[model samples]
Target: MLIAQISDPHVRPAGQLYQGVVDSNRMFEEAIAHLHALDRRPDLVLLTGDLVDEGRSEEYAEARRLLAKLSIPYLVIPGNHDHRENFRTAFADHAYLPATGALHYCIDTHPVRIVALDSCIPGLHHGHVDAEGLAWLQRTIEADREKPTLLMLHHPPFTSGIPYMDSYRYIDTAPLEAIVRSVGNIELVLCGHVHRTMLKRWAGTVVCSCPSSTTEIALQLAPDAAPASYLGRPGCMLHLWDEAQGMVSHVSYIGKMDGPYPFA
Candidate 1:
């Protein structure tokens, strides 16, 4: 099975730009187009969060309008920029989402199992999974200990050297890490919110944080580095799963580029 992961689209209303500058909606359109143009079509698409810029209904409407161009099966979880109720109402047709509380669920139909966690702290930018959410995860993962699983959450589990961004990560990760460490069947833990590509070996598996479809967060490692971002080579994550290869991931950049030259 193959899955394409796109994060932090931050879609604005029609005629508006993300943060009133970058044309994130158009960029997201390009990302959808890129996915559609892949050599081998993906069986599913995973949207890691921040679907809309400000959690507004109009933004979600515009997002849905742009999303009309995509025809693949996709799953989405809320990010800090998303309002839970508004997001829930926006995708009301997605029956997999819980009717109330955190937007966490598990999908078992594919060759690889998918478990998505809602990490947003309502009106706050930082994230956390309360005891209730963690309890649900523990039960879900514990129920099926042998499936090739992927854990999806908005926040990457490690403290990325991007100091400014790390300030907004999920608080108190000890418990979540414990649950993940207890499970050996989880092939990878996929995340977003850092807006740049990141990888780490964690909990006896791999954790991959995808780049945004709109902007690339500056990779500053200094302790006092200030927050900054740019509209650079926006990209997404392509995860391929097979019995022999397991989960192999690649960062697929968007927009046109000079390539396919013969090996000299």
Candidate 2:
């Protein structure tokens, strides 16, 4: 199975630029086109979070229109930029999602079991998981210990060194980390709030944060650095999974670039 992970498109309404600068919707469209053009089409796609610039109905409408072009099936979780209720209403057709409360569920049809957790705090930029949400996650993972599981959430559990971005990082860590550490079958904990590709060995498994489909948050580690992002080369993560081989992730950069010149 091949899964494509794209994050933080921050799509704006039609004819509008995201943050009054970059055309994120068009970039997201290109990212979808990129997925379609791949030699092997992805079996599934995961939109990590921040699907729109704002939690407006129009933004979700535009996002829905652009996402309709994707031929592959996809799953979405809410980010701080997304309004929980609006997101739920926008993708009401996705029966896997819960009708009320947190947008959390488990999918077992795929080769890997996907346990997506809702980490958004409604009206806040930071993320948190209440006792009920955490308990749900623990029970969901415990249900299938033999299956290769991928835990999906919007915010990364660890504090990224990036000063500004870390300001809005996930707040419920200790308990969550304990839960993940005890789960033996969790193959990967996938996240997207950081907007840049990041990897870390945590809780007996790995956490891979997908890159943004639009602008990338600048990699500034200085404490005094200001919050900023740039219209950099957008990209996505293609995860190839096989029963024997496990999973190997490759980064596929979007837009035109240099040729596939032979290194040999």
Candidate 3:
């Protein structure tokens, strides 16, 4: 099975732009068009987080409208920029999401099982998985140990070198780490919120952060480099799972590029 992961669209209202620069809605439109045009379309799409620039109801409504155009099934989790209530209300058809409390659920598709964890702390930019949330995760993973599982959350569990972004890294990771190490079937931990593509080995599994569908965080790794972003190549992660190769992920940049020139 093939799964496409898109994150950090940060979709703004119809007439507004994200951060006064990015036309996030347009970017998402292009991203969706790219997905639809793929020769081998994905079985499903996983939207990690940051669905909108603000947690406004109208923003969520706009995001929902755009996402509805996808031909394949899709799932979404809350990010720091998302308001749980608004998101739940907007995507009411997504029954996996809890009506109240944290938005967490387990999806059992054909080849793999997806365990989505809610790491968003309301009214806060940083992320945190409290004891309760961690406990839920532990129980969920422990219950299904044989399935090839993928853990999805909005925040990266490890510290990224980007100082400005690292400051908002997920807090209280020890519990989640312990759970992940204990459960050997977890194939990958998928994350967003940094607005850039990053990969790290943690807790006996690979953690990959998908680049934003709208604008990308500058790859500034210096200790003092301030936070900045640009409209670089928007992208998504395509994960393929099969009996032979297990799970393989590829970064697919959106939009058309130059010709497929021969290597000389």
Please name the candidate that would achieve the greatest lDDT relative to the true structure.
Answer: 1
In order, the Cα lDDT scores of the candidates are 0.94, 0.92, 0.91
**Which pairs clash inside model 1?**
none
Model 2 lDDT tens row, 5-44: 9988998999999888999989999999999999999999
Ranking by lDDT: 1, 2, 3
List the pairs of residues colliding in candidate 3. none
User: What lDDT score goes with residue 26 in model 2?
Assistant: 91
Candidate 3 per-residue lDDT, tens place, 121-180, comes to 999988888888888898999998999999999999998899999888898788889989
Give the Cα error of residue 90 in candidate 3, in Å: 0.6
Stretches of candidate 3 off by over 4 Å are: 262-264
Write model 1 residue lDDT over 1-264, tens digit each, in one string. 999999999999889988878999999999999999999999999999999989999999998888889999999998999999999999999999999999999999999999999999998999899999999999999999998999999998789988899899888888999999998999999999999999999888989999999999998999999889987999999999999889899999988888888886
Candidate 1: RMSD to truth: 0.9
CA RMSD (A), model 2: 0.9
